[model samples]
Target chain A: MREDHHDQPHAPDHPMTEFEWRVDAVQALLIEKGVITADEVRRAVEEMDARTPAQGARVVARAWVDPAFKARLLADAKATIAEIGITVGFDATIVAVENTEKVHHAVVCTLCSCYPRGLLGYPPDWYKSLNYRSRAVVEPRSVLSEFGLELRSDVEVRVLDSTADMRYLVIPVRPAGTEGMSEEELADLVTRDSMIGVAQARTPALR
Target chain B: MTRVHDRGGWPGSGPIDKSEHDLSWWEKRTDAIASLLMSPEKRVMRVDELRRAIEDMEPARYEQSRYYAKWLHAIETIMAEKGVLTREEIDRKVRELSARR
Candidate 1:
């Protein structure tokens, strides 16, 4: 159901940026020569769109309720996540680190904006911004405080740097007094920020 | 070259713009093309390689362009380097596409 831009002429009055023109030309040529089809491009768009925080919440939810799944998530995240039928575009490894009362894990890609895009959708604007890349690892506690998440002074913060080959996912601690909650109920506490380790999972009252 | 696109610990930061805005059609297309270039299923190129290509951009252009613009630069550069699409052909196609509009 995508619009066909093949025949549309740009109104001379409205100029496109250089990159926009380049993409148009490159895509058109690629499609014409059969290197890649518009369908493939459309599928890529849909696949990226399909990746959302809900998927991450689902994974976090299961991990919270099932110790076995949580163990597998920490030991071999890609394999276990795939077992649950989730596929991210990149072929790199994703490692899940859990937070405990004694320690917290915060993820950052200092090199570039490496992220678990398959699970969290596009990294938020803040995630990719120069501000986040610079501050996340250098002063994570302060960063979290800005996100309204002030970790206890004694909580050890482990900043995980993601390389091109490996991404990191932070599994936040399960909130207290929720033993009777179902996986779906537990999943509701999981937010993108919590999974990224900037914030804690939502409490029952917040929902 | 070392800094490349690495913004880690570079400088002070202003407030983050938290408002979410929808991407334009071209930006979405650029995203698709960029991701498809590194699709695990299709395997056209490594994301590191694309990063390298992007890093090779003129320093000013690298810093001045928007993220999607950088993606376009990387994609076009890598495609040309891989012989998937020649630079001239892309230029010609751009002219054709623009003329259509």
Candidate 2:
């Protein structure tokens, strides 16, 4: 009987919880009813798995190297990102906020985990945590500091709340040095935290 | 009126948990299920509808469930509401799977 469980898809070492079992049951029934095919589920999982911070890094690196593209990304993020071959299936508008010496920007979806999943994969656990969702809007400096990003007094901190219809991706300023580095190399320096605006892009020395 | 799901600026929510774990197999499948159901080709439900379901959860239950678990709750709620699947059918399926184990 236990072996039968192993034969099942996504069987865990321990017994599945009620919620976990419900997830399986939902999928099974949905497939049975022809609402969604197993193949479609597999394809969706693969598509989501394929998306990662790397894609967002590629976009940011391009913006760092190309002034024209940066302007376009800020002007129209949804279409500009699509031009780079990243498919955004949803209709939510993505806004690219630039982090400069005078201003810093961080993103939080206070209502729910409304991230730009099409570009940066799923939101991190902390991004969806109540602490972040509650404090990011009111006390962004403290939140950024916990992420090891200490901004100077002169820099204005802006916390962008991601709504159901709007998502924000922060473009951290390029680190000092590495003047002649290639776009690929620059992409390597763009960490996920940096793009979320909790931290800045990695300096060349750190990379 | 602020709902339980609307937690912006609620104060003293504590520090952000930086730890991250790889999604469990069921969690991944739940996400995939949601994406496919809400995909343009299927249009069985919209993201907004799913979100509304989540927001409609009781405050205590909403806070207790894990992230993907909340999504599952939402999916089940929407499915039942849309007449795609009933709670009774899902309950029976769960029992069937449990009996096999």
Q: Which one wins on lDDT?
A: 2
True contacts kept of each: 0.71, 0.84
lDDT of each: 0.80, 0.87
Best by TM-score: 2
Worst 10 residues of 1 chain A by lDDT: A1-10
**Tens-digit lDDT track of model 2 for A65-162:** 99999999999998998888987667478889999999998998899888888888878889889889999998899889899999999998888888
Q: What TM-score does chain B of candidate 2 reach?
A: 0.96
Interface root mean square deviation for model 2, in Å?
1.3
Report model 1's interface C-alpha RMSD after superposition on the true interface residues: 2.2
Q: Which ten-residue region of model 2 chain B has the weakest summed lDDT?
A: B20-29
Candidate 1 matches the true fold with a TM-score of: 0.89
Best by DockQ: 2
Off by over 4 Å in 2: A1-12
Question: At residue A48, what lDDT does model 2 achieve?
Answer: 85
> DockQ for model 1?
0.63
